[model samples]
Target: MNFASAWNAQGPLARQRREAMLARVGQLRALEQRAAERSAEARAVFEKRGQLLPRERVGLLLDPGTPYLPLCTLAGYLQDAREPDASVPGGGVVAGIGFVRGVRCMVVASDSGIDAGAIQPMGLEKILRVQEIALQNRLPFLHLVESAGANLMRYRVEGFVQGGALFRNLARLSAAGIPVITVQHGSGTAGGAYMPGLSDVVIMVRGRSRAFLAGPPLLKAATGEVATEEELGGAEMHTAMSGLGEYLAEDDRHALGIAREVVGRLGRAPTPALPQGGRVTASLPPPPGEGWGGGAPQREDLLTLMPANLREPVDMREVMVRLVDDGILEFKPLYGAATLCAQGRIGGHAVGFVSNNGPIDVPGANKATHFIQWMCQLGHPIVYLQNTTGYMVGRESEQGGMIKHGSKMIQAVTNATVPQLTIQCGASFGAGNYGMCGRGYAPRFLFSWPSARTAVMGGEQAARTMQIVTEAAHGRKGQRPDPVQAKAQFDKIVQVFESQADAFYTSGLLLDDGVIDPRDTRAVLAFCLDTIAEGEAAQPRPMQFGVARM
Candidate 1:
């Protein structure tokens, strides 16, 4: 047969073949459009959650306009079975090289909508792959976690064999001194919590997030006790009681913002400023009021500024701001309201400030411990403002582990080698005094203000002691005096406790060096700093022991 005749005879099948090819091409194009739509929807969902998507988060965390090098564009293989979704990058765990605050960082962000962000067998492999990347590059690893848990069914099917490799990788990164920061944007339950907990810093948003060893249902089943998510693992729970996390945020955006700031602080090059001299001291405010002995300012102003009644309270933070440098950086500022610790430049040199609110005891001590630890790390000087009544006592105090935690503060101060300057503002008595880095604790210089009520106990205790003594004398003499006469006798004896027999008495005994004006505190600190600088430079080495975990 002729070639043309044969082609015509086969025309029906050829036409059908061409039509099939066209149909497949159209189908693929439609799929591409649908995928673009789905991605857009995913971005929109992230916006609704007040969070940036994983890719966008990576972009913002890195240096401006820096491009991210994705770790893997597809999930890894199994023994022989091909994963239907193997084409997806990282199998829903998006990991790659990025930057935070202009410093290089490696990131692994989970997309919850994808398999509920569960760590399937393949997912675990992906996580380990990224961890290896971080360690190899010597970059900080940032985890944006919103995971339900390991894929339980997949894990069972695989004989629970996928977790060890991932955890080993985490331990390796941790040992390398490459910091890891985890941001819990949503539910972090089951095995998921371990990923973040292993990190150096854990940042969490408020209502939209939770993190725990297990979810509520599992806990209820395992323990037969039902607890709300917040009770189990909320921001408040972690920040205040457990101290599992370093920072807490009101929302995802806030968490990310703090992450950026923290990365900057951690990654900056250490540049210690030069020590200052007498010229710097001269510029400081005058000492406390005239009554305290130093010629700077009056201690009486403190009494008037504070209410006479003990029940009335003053904001110690405002007092600290007025006394310290203008550019103070407060730590755990929201978690502990009663204590304030900050790092700032004093006389152009970095120093740590530890101050307390009279109404709050252990929190103040806790804050002080953290400050001292930070100072030790930086090899900087520390200044303590002692203004606590005493260590808090009561049912609440006991539950807070006040005694043990407060002891930690005292130990930290005693062990600190940095030049510690202590200013007794008011009411430094009992254990609280020693915990405040008292004179006995070997401060470089200990100065008390005239208004300082430094007794073995507070003024109220003095009044009580006087009342008891007078009552005993009256009973022994068999003489009942009028209320007026009794009042006079009690007042005279109580006055003994209030006068030089107090802090002034200690000063006379040389237990306390002397009192200084409150306003002159700045000058005094500057002078101390200059003196320390003249005698010796700081050791230039970290303390060997008793380092508090950050």
Candidate 2:
């Protein structure tokens, strides 16, 4: 590995900019905190019902001192432009990967305290992403479910149509030999009933859970019959009569105890072997920590390294030195100057890092395509640090076959079997986003720095394009464009475009898994990569189909 000596760790200008960027990272963290705390707003109601808040359930379910990676923390910010500040906390769910009884599992709980855990459009998308992660990683799926079903008043047909995939995924997980465990806390009526019905193991809170296909009002409307929630599908009835529930618990705390017991006994795949070296999950037996012992760049330096201003250019090598272990081993550097592909270690996991120095030209994209293929052959994970304006444009580039080369990069990213993680450190615009595994392509885990901006193109570029078209259209109509009016129009368009590109805006819509502090990048990537590695190493026993209810 070549030692990196270009960065002056104590440069005065770097310190000044680092401090400012640190404040922005802090601001985004505060917003996430506020959103997470929204569940506390329903504390009184939860207490009245003698229940714990959704997050509280999650806390008790997870083993103490173990790590948990929260996903989609802010799932609906500014989505309803009518009321931008309205809190849409956590997509009506509090979910992440956590450990239970020495077993690593995907833990998800309904955030019923807020809006009765009703899923909106983005909320539905959040669960779908969670399910996909659970399936891909071969993690056992565990959930504490008590939802009021979808919010019909704010419904979109697309969300409803896509929501069915959640149930389908549950079945797929079970069929794939991945356990689907669920706890019903309360009100699993109507469509919500399917959650418990499809689980491999269902734990029900005795008097609290109400998982009937129809409640009394609906029953009377449909069949002119009277039925209480218990008679239809209460915990006791389900356990003794319906055979839907596997275990009955006295209360919330007791239910979690049983759920932990379930994970401990569900038949583990194998004690998955670790690779050469990498950071190990605390839940797993510890491996040697990935570090050089000393002189590593300060994690906070990342804030200064990646300027918040998208237009500013910084050598990605400088950023790479601060992220990888003892700097990276360069590969084909002179062949493609704009794309920096190198071999490195993060948390001890051997990985290939592809970072953008600028817009990807034909050579850069081709280099990336070749590197991605080689990494897949080695079975190593690839980390894409997105900082590009996207593929180069213009007649010269087109004649040079920019599209053909760019498509190769996209194809490699899409089909590579190795786990891919995307971190949007700066500008992720145009084809750059797709080539870098934007949310649409679904990186195994995707996150953005508070400084990141994502869109089809930069705000200024989009505005200028619109401005030129407006002037041309007015001239064709034989009316000259008004100068002052045209300037105002350009400014308005930029504001709209930039707002949509902001990390907070995109993260809220569940565009990325969540925004992170610049310092947490290395550790977060290491943990996820380790999980994927572990999953890949395990030997799961797959049946022909999902276990069916007797």
Candidate 3:
């Protein structure tokens, strides 16, 4: 069914909402700038050393005029700072998927500007998550290494145990046939030495690069042996003597150039065409004033399409129209009227969309389950537009087996063969999040809009529920409840939920990849889908293990 937008961008309500959304977007940009500024503080030092900053290296390595989707920009926000104002996000690393010599690759650069790039707990998780995406999508992994490794002063036993996964994933990527390339730009001591060791190709900076099982102090203390860094794991030693590195460069810029050349030589094949009439979806031209390439839908009306207030319902199809290249093919629209399952194209890539007009009912759950399976079987990526209060509740819903059906939907989301991406545009409470491939469920990439709010339930409803339980306890004890105390308790509960459910708060905690402007939804989806497609097209020779130092 073709979607016709009745959205009026010039309408009074829409104008108001656009202004509000634009302000929120400004706030998100400000946070990103703060992280950049924090990194910029090291510019003088980098210049003195005749080296490029991490961000600059990334820019040089990427193909000109291509898109780079930065991941987890708000990571370690508020989690590591003494005050919210002092928080520097980015989790001590700069990571994204971008074109390297016309080939899409996952690039991770250590943001050594801050605290010498010591791994924050969230930073570890961020690296692991991106590595997982690279492995699952079969994209090459490129890492720019230069770190002090973990901060033993602030380390926890659990972090130490979980940190093992980082090294294991590097080997896993190599064994799975995806290339793991490393540029030893500065320091990689202790366990960090394994980063370059496991890479299929390692490029090292001559004077500056270092990777060793133990640095001078640690080696002297533990083994009563002392050796200069150069003799132990410097670029010259690693490349010529130890055979750990394949290429040795003179400086950061030279190293990055070598990395780019290596990627160019990888001989990655062009992305394969989608099966089952993929070109048909992009047959229509984009609406007037909407200017994304490949006939993608209009994004100009996006701010107007979504109401500022989440409780006010808007047709999910209206939002979908702006994201896809052409009209959507609604699947069993009549069966689950509120839960929409449609086939569309983003950036000319075939995709399946599951969105919510309201809470998920039994019919909705069953419909989504079937749609997910259908998309997986066809090998199309799934994009979830999450905006649900939760599953329907009440005697009528419970008897209808809401739990069974909702579980089926979650199971499908959890085990779907193809890539699944999620965008939280509005309310995402309780299990609705899980069923829609929320952060916990490990969606390939999950993003949120400024209007998003996530919680177990609405603040008022949670407060009221608690109030009722408290009153019942008092009645059972044959005592009257104090009105003032009960009111104060209810207010406290509401305050906590309301504060924690804000989009900024959740994003600061790394709940989603990053909060995005609603207008950029289509562009983001297209980049992600293209990455997945490229991965599907690639074929690399799997080995029993990573290229060893020998």
Candidate 4:
């Protein structure tokens, strides 16, 4: 690794930026904790019915003292229509890949504590993504089902159409020989009732479980036949008559115990590797200190390296030094100087790096395309540090085949068969966000630094473009443009853009998984890389059709 550290911490600006970043991280974490506690409403409701809260159910379901990778914790962040301040995160489910009786499974518990755990649009996206993860990694799928289904009043046609895919995926998981275990903790009526219907192993909590095609009110309205929840599809009824539930538990605790035993009986996955890793050490080694001698810059140097202003230029090299281990093996540094492609080890995991210091021109795009493909060929994961104004625009770039070259970069990013992890370190605007594996393109994992800002274009640029368009529209209408009114509108638009582009706002909407402390980047990247590696090494069984409950 060639080492030349240029990051030297000095002024008050660094201190100010560091303080701001830390405070934002703290605020977001607090919001998440607050959302979890807000489930107290549901807790009270459940308590009246003699039941545990959603989180409590999740904790009881998983094995103790094991890692739980809670994902997309800020799912319906600011998207709620009621009020911004009243919005709850976590969509409506608490889920992650964790262990149960030494067996790895994807566990999901509906946060019925909030609005009866109604499925929000973002929550739907979260569950679908987790299902894909469990299937691809060959992990047994588990569901702690208890939801009010979708909110009919706020329902979108797209959600209704897409929601069917979840059940289909469940069927696919079972057909692929991956066990689908579901515990009906509470109400699962209407379309939601399919939870127990599609699972290979179903455990229903007596008196608590409620799964039916339609509840009493809906049944009365549709068929003029009034049927109680228990008579239709309760734990006892399903276990004894319908055979929908394989086991009937006396209560929440009994239900969780039965689920654990079920997982234990399945033993290890067909591939035989746990998602969080199986090897256990007696004790964890101390984190590497200053004297450990990796030659990498101190983690705190990140604050000094990052510029507070987006327009101010920064050499990504200075930032890279603080992230890569023992410096980096610079790749194609001279050919596409604007796009730095380097090889490095972070937390001892070998990875190829691609970062942008400016707009991607013809050469930079091609260089990135070549480097991405090379990393895939080498079987090493690629890490993208996104900070670009996007592809250079204008007549000259057009003549230089910028369109064709930029297409090559996008193509490589979309099709490369490797674990691509993206870190939005700074500005992520326009096509640069897409080429750098933004949330839409679906990197294996996408994280942002608290200092990051993402949008189609910078606020000033977007505002100016709109202003010019407004003037042109006025001229076409044969009226003089009102400069004062236009300026007021322009400023408001800019403020909206800047505010929404904040890392916290974007993360709250599930645009990124969650913001990370810049200091934790290397370690977080290592953990994610190791996970995909272990998954790729596993082998799974496949069947022609899904296994039935019988």
Model 2, position 147: C-alpha lDDT score: 89
Worst 10 residues of 3 by lDDT: 277-286
Scored by Cα lDDT, where does model 2 land? 0.81
Candidate with top lDDT is: 3
Runs in model 3 lying further than 4 Å from the true structure: 270-297
What tens digits encode model 2's per-residue C-alpha lDDT throughout 1-550? 4747576657876776687677776666565556556767888988887888887788788776555677787687777664655655466777787777757789888888778888767777888889999899999999899888878788778877788898999999999889999999988877789899889999999889888888889899999999888999889999899899989998988999999888888777433332222222322112122221232356757767877576677787777777777668877888778888998898788899898989999999999999999999998889999999999999999999999999999999999988899998899999899999898887999999888899998778889999889889998999988999989989998998899999889998888998876776876787788779778876677888887876
**Residue lDDT tens for model 4, 375-469:** 99998889999899899999999999999999999999999998899999999999999999999888888888877899999999999999989
**TM-scores for every predicted model:** 0.42, 0.92, 0.92, 0.89
Global Cα lDDT for candidate 4: 0.80
Please state the error at residue 313 of candidate 3 in Å.
1.7
Per-candidate clashes come to: 13, 3, 0, 0
Cα lDDT, all candidates = 0.60, 0.81, 0.84, 0.80
Give RMSD to native, each candidate.
Answer: 33.1, 4.2, 5.1, 4.5
Worst lDDT run of 10 residues, candidate 2, spans: 284-293
Clashes of 1: 13
Candidate 2, RMSD to the unseen true structure: 4.2
Off by over 4 Å in 4: 9-11, 269-305, 322-326, 471-480
The candidate, 1 or 3, that scores higher on TM-score is 3
User: Local error of candidate 3 at 497, Å?
Assistant: 1.8
Runs in model 1 lying further than 4 Å from the true structure: 1-49, 76-89, 157-159, 268-550
